[model samples]
Target chain A: MISFQHNRREFLKSSIGLAGLTLPTFLKARAESVGSRIPHKAKSCIIVYTWGGMSHYESFDPKPEAPADIRGPFGNIPTKTPGIRFCEYLPKLAHHSEQLAIVRSVHHKHGGHQQGMYINLTGKDPVGGIKAKSRKNWPSITSMISRFHNPTVGTPAAIRMPYSMYDNGTMMAGEGAGWLGSKYDPILLRTPAGKPYAGVNRYNDRELKLERNIEKRRVTDRLGLLDQLDNSLSHTINGSTPYERLDHYGQMAADMLLGSPVRRAYELEQEDPRIREMYGDHIGGQTLLLSRRLVEAGVPVVQALCSASDLAGGSGDNWDTHRDHFPKMKNRLLPVFDKSVSALLTDLEMRGMLEETLVVFLTDFGRTPKVNNNGGRDHHPGVYSLAFAGGGIQGGLTYGSSDRKGVEPGSEACSPADIHATVYNAMGIDHHTELYDQQGRPFQICDGEPLPII
Target chain B: MVGTFNVMEKLYYIFAIVLINSVHPLQAEPEALRDIERLNGIALKLPEGGWEVGFQLRGQKLNDEDMEAVVRLGSIVSLNLRDTQITSAGLAHLKKLSMLRRLHLERTKVDDAGIGHLTNLQKLEYLNLYGTKVSDEALEHLGQLHRLRKLYLWQTLVTQKGVNKLKNINPKLDISLGIDLTTIVVTNQKSEAKKKTEDLPQLEWLPEEGAKRPPDRSYTGSFIMVYFENNRSKPVKLYWINYNGEQTYYANIDAGQRREQTSYSRAVWLVTDLQEKRLGYFVTDQNTSRAKIPLE
Candidate 1:
């Protein structure tokens, strides 16, 4: 009787253990089935973030019928699409409308720059006193998307060029890998060649100047010096134990500098001069050119901030046109933007890279409908515009719309999270998928349904 | 009792094997498909019961034998062989992929003879033959694909006549012949020449000892090109006043040398002697103009 009881207990224990092991397998099968439903079209993503709030009325949704105060001084020009019209300043981009899917009904509630940037970048509302590089925040969209991509060994998973986003002098949050740990943080690289944006750009000292003159023997010594500098900087910036000791960024930098496709991609001088001129000689144009090269070099995601690094009270070359809005948009901003973005589309199509590369335009909330006393537009979180192209997206289609007055969403209202969900859907990431934090706490990556634009 | 326990253990082992197999159904896939995957070719299974194979990344070593391995997988919906080492002879193996919906043969060696095998692929929707050696004869073979929606013949030997013929067969077909590359270059150069002759804002040269000295540091501004004509008797050192107000050496302009310097508007350029004594400076503007250093 005793032996029989022992055998029964052992049998139950084995059955339970097997059941526990098979449960995850069954769950994985279901998860994969859900994921395979969405065809994976984008192998890489290029995020064009216009730092300050890019005016919807001036870029994609020009309202000719609105009052002068609401419509501002810009006129509407007909695009390739019959019914679609863009601001007169964007004549070049108007020609490429067939390849763009403009979303004019995106809106959020954040009015401040930091809060608005946090929502746009991470697709999550700020919780409380959120600080940059804090582990309690959500992972940025670039970092999250890059986590799923497996690039060739040596290439950084994600890279943000030129400079980090800053307001006056304060660095913005939602630009780092939060709960995903420091490993998934997007590496910041300075655009080696290009005219610098007019503003006080902080955090420009972290660049590795791998000039051709550096001898092979001194390479090791240079790398060692970089490591020490990075360690000390990380300590001061992070205000915690060094994250590099736990991440592979230091080793990856060495690997890239020693000789990799990424190193070759950085030599912009080798590109055809005509192509460089086509992108324009501005920093904005060069940044987009570098983005194309980096994508070809196998970097999964790249975020190019199109505006000046710092929004120093809208004084320099930023989209923050709080004063002299018409002159700024017509002279400094529109020409470079229209030319470079159109060149990118044309270049990608000619090389057959557009089919696999996704280009997205994001910004803070749209400008207000009423012209301000300063002769500029104020922050309007009521309704705004964003755009997506390539990577299997149906072009020449406008997904949503604002009212006639350009104040609020009139039809197919969507949020920044919904746009994020659409991107994940295009890139083959299941929006409802859960990722665990360092503490093993599972969090749903996104909470919105994907738009039908795909 | 001992015998019963042993039997239960054997049942557990069988159940575990079944569960593991169900979890990884790819284990049951043919070894040829796995071999292609080992070569970094993606063999993703579509939810609608077909495979999507791509060799766009790391496909330099792929040859005719690899195409045979791809055919063995059977139900491929989309196949991307762009930039691969596959030849016209290798495309003979693609005849078996009748279920293919989208095919990317761009930048490959596939020509008219190779494209002939794709006529039987009735379900094909997208075909990209750009940068290939295909001529009008290839379009003749492609026109037979009635369901083809998008065809890219850029940089090919195909002419407008071939594209028109394909369009006649299927009026709904979207054919892209792309712009000529050389024409763009010529036009851009012409426009560039025209721009140089246009009116430009001339920058004022501020002598070092003059009342109106240039700003100590450069400020960020729009991109512009400045033509510096060194009329001085000796070679002068050109230094850019950096954002930090520090002197960063850029180049040395020999006497009577014309150096085209790319700079930004509002940037200050200081000219000095070989001994680094400042002579004169010029602040750039938003137009391309000439900055000539006068002989003192």
Candidate 2:
């Protein structure tokens, strides 16, 4: 009985692990492009970060044929003008599938949101770090892109709209640039209030705290300069660096506040009010619209996170739904995301920015195939989907098929690094390019391949 | 990303091949622990007995949750951490593990007052020296760890032999030395290794290559990845060919006598301890392909 019990536990553990096993071809292919993709295709990226994970079954990849429990209560609807089917809640993005490429096989080594975020952002495993979450997290791909490629011009390469978030006071994992250092941190825009209004919460207030620090430092700098004093040593010793890579950040911050295209990047009101209304006045919708403005303003990468609060508060904007998933997606999550994502894609393509800008809707991982007694899905990293549209990728195409039971991928399985590699490939950054830590030792930026999406 | 390294790690998470260098990789040499160069590939045999764990490596990604797993497995006795990114802010979490014995804070950001809180850990055996900014003045507060045997005082203002005199006051105490890893070689089991050049299924071509001369042929083991997965159990012929495409075949167990006069094939075998999860090659020729022959 003890042996049987042990075996049962092992099976359950592996069921989660096995899902992360797929996707080598993706990383390898992407790494192969590292040195070769330098003078290439896409030049910019727009990341639509649904703060919480979104339900695959309720949005892009509906399991209409599955049981009622797995399929939830939502029904499918024809999107835009065609045969493409999407959950009724995601009505906006449905019509634009022809321009999007969805990968139902994307997965990774860890299913937890933080771990998944590590894979997505760094294209690597947890390496050496504490799981408690801290402000010293690894950097994001956009940071790497900004670090590698810089902006289209010189307007500070990366931008994050409205605000960057933390979970319950603990820094959210994988949100900041971990090993990449500070030079690549996105210029987080402090959102202003008004209609199609910028949203704020307890989280926003925290963002304000960060804004205060930036302000205080500015005052200290000005006062010290007037006194003809040098506080360089204090800045150097305390901030972990003697002002090497970190030096660029202060200047970048000053540039943003002083106003330039960088200042104008997150301003959505400057856009025709009708267009803003079309995208909806909600927090998520406005952020997506705001992201496009940054891209237009020549920001190479823009990250816009829609709140988990937009759906339900406790679980975090993280889409890890241990329960109540069906109601949330069919009600709050899907409709808002669907409308905003759809608007961004349409607006970009219509403006012809779609060719140069890669728009990605990514989450930590997908929910489970089966629901529990709690009437919701738990974390299911095994088989979920991610969608990519525009920016040199084939459109209206769906790659990789999951098995009939939707328990695992029946077609090609992919790791998060593969998706990250593909993004690097599209952006013309060598996915294989090695990054040296403060020590000169070389570490491969990504080991995964470009999801045969190209 | 999908790669051998990633897959290998997923297959097994218990391995402790963690790479830790000075938090400031840019410095010419790490400020502390210079004697401890590389721990990336070292596997350790964790000892038993004792309950204590503490470290300070500020800013380093400590994977704090993993420590929970480490302590859950058994009692953590001693920790040696010096010149790390872990900061004082994280020290608050360390206090919860009341079972901590000897905490090493060499070159850590922990203040003299922070050391005072650890007074509750009565089981601490050896406290490392010079890891923190604590002065000899702070030694009075550390008097709380009565169970403490030896206090390290290297590179600190505290005279080493002098501290020994103070620690010796405990009549029942027996202070000792501490040690970490020296060397460890981690290799995957045979069942886990595929396409191994050392052991494989055989191919027969002896009479086919009638050279009679062992002098005419050879086998060369590849320096790169040398393994393959095969499932067969028959006596077979293996061969080796040089750059000129000249080949030689050998099956170590010859049924007949030597063909001294005839131009027959000769065999050279690869040495392997074929104990399950393994297949040993026979008569490898240094000039050509690494093929397998029967073990006879």
Candidate 3:
């Protein structure tokens, strides 16, 4: 049987991690949504965010009958699922199709990179065509989950691997704890240690290391000094923004930094050699492995940026294939994605983590139907594909589809909000539950109705 | 009674004038009309920007010289030169068409040299080199076209390796690399790559340099970016040989400073100091926008 059994303390730790600080506030508001108290179907979630828009036509929704120009290059290949076809490049994913559910009709309105990313990551539209990211933007789905299920132990509630989504010199929106306090922000494992790309960020300077000459007595003295300083500040502050609350966050950060389990979770080198080989040495593969380790170590959420970092300078090769699309997908992009995703699914299933772990695959949006003059596709917000598996999600099924030319949604059109709702349902969080912002303004976590299939 | 009659007559004339003006709005010729007849190309001004130059019918009339003269007008959105008498020399004229979205060079003498001229056409979306002398080398020139969608290499000299190389640049690009169903080619199952210190050295981090950069921010040009990634522990002064073969002082890059800039294609980076003492040099190629100088 797929085990959903973890220690009760682990469960409580994840659900109400801010025991000494924010627990009272949660308890008072908990009665509004009794569903928040229910047992979660999934213990963890690994969201593989494929930034820069992976093409639907080339990956999940291959229309071979369409014109050569519309269909592009690759032909369709049979998956393990009956009557379902994927791109020829995704050979490994095709074999493991039985363990996956491909949703092919997730559509939205934002076409720009920042706008689409905002909607996809947060399930909320930008206040306007908000270009630069700000603190006013809606909190990411991971942040909302972190707020609901705060990790109790030294482990953080959520983490993001390698680096955050960046285009040119500007950082994209919706990859942070907007509206939510900075404490709920996902811990970013920027890069690994000496290896830089393979090992977890825990193997680097992120893990707390005392200076060579500084002894434990000096550290204790400094803490005492900090406490005295806090007492002095407390006299002046009259509001609830007290020194104790700041100390709570500081204490949590210190605990996380000094934690051994968190560091061990990021140590990919300690994993079995065969298992490491299963997930390729590529950045995406290693990051997914790290995500699995994190979830196993009691992290509720791990958002991974599935991309090849080597392509940053080479005409921006992170899935934004506006030209030479087929060559890139066939040779570099698709092969890495197919191998890594397949390995993750297989590894999770073998380890019996799939049943209690929701694996969500997402992208910015779909590409245009008509190929452009540069032999590539432009941004199209009409329709795209995303996927969810494990965590009570049925496998070997395609939820919805695009039109004949793979342009717009044909039937069962879904939005990013609906996908968010489905994910919350899988996690056993009430989709209709209301959460307050920094100013105490009430807002629904997800606006769209949850899919009946989940 | 005479005044009212005169006023009524004036109103009728005014109404007639308004009706005439609405029906017959004046039309101006397109911006390229002055030279369109000489080039035998149709020019239609877009409502937004640039001109759509169509040479579908009389493409054979335009030669290399005519192509040069016509492209000088600039702001061309689309250029259809199918079955034209133009050669590789004519492609140099298309370098200024930064707004070009569609280009058809089918059945022309355009080859790899001609395609090289189109590397700067960043907005070019549709490129048809069908029935031309284009080979594997033509794909090299197309690496910078991040917006390309439909490429027609049908009946050309492109191989599977060449097409795969181009696909690595932009995975979404739909190129016609003619995979015949009749031939069942078996690919070799190679062993996994041997474990190395670093498989992809281009992506490795260099020693951090402490050199400060001026905040002028006006230096902008389309060139291969050369990154002075000092993999060693020491500081190095960087120099580059320009097109004129003169070695000029670039910068004194500190060990902790990781500096990168768009530079010349065949630019040779000579690592030296203020005393003209030579350390080493890294020669950059056209294929990649980056070149790391890992001084030992």
Model 1, span A1-454: residue lDDT tens: 4663344334323322233221222222233444523667787899999988999999999999998778977788999999999999899899899999999999999998888889999999988999888999889999998776645445678888778888888888898899988778887776776666655567643444444523454456545645464445424333342433322443354345545567777788877776787787778988899899888777889998898988977766788877556657876788889988998888777666786898999998898898764456888889999999988788998988999999999999999999999989888888988888989989989977888988
Better by TM-score, candidate 3 or 2: 3
The residue ranges of model 3 lying beyond 4 angstroms of the native Cα positions read A1-40, A129-133, A191-251, A308-314, B1-296
Poorest stretch of ten by lDDT in candidate 2 chain A: A20-29
How large is the interface RMSD of each prediction?
Answer: 10.1, 35.8, 31.6
What is the lDDT, from 0 to 100, of the residue A279 in candidate 2? 64
Ten residues in a row with the worst lDDT in model 2 chain B? B35-44
lDDT scores in order: 0.77, 0.52, 0.66
lDDT of 3 by residue, A208-287 (tens): 22222224553465455434534543332333334334433443433333433566666677876556666666677788
lDDT tens digits, residues A200-304, model 2? 233443232233334566545533432231234223323433232332433343343333455554556677665665566666777778777766655778877
Q: Which residue pairs clash within candidate 1?
A: none
Question: lDDT per residue, candidate 3, B7-38, as tens digits?
Answer: 64345334433432343232222223335533
Best by the TM-score measure? 1
DockQ of 1: 0.13
Error of 2 at B222 (Å): 66
Off by over 4 Å in 1: A1-37, A152-155, A203-261, A372-374, B1-28, B186-198, B201-296
| Cα misplacement distance, residue A361 of candidate 3 (Å) | 0.5
All models, DockQ values? Answer: 0.13, 0.01, 0.01
Compute the DockQ of candidate 3.
0.01
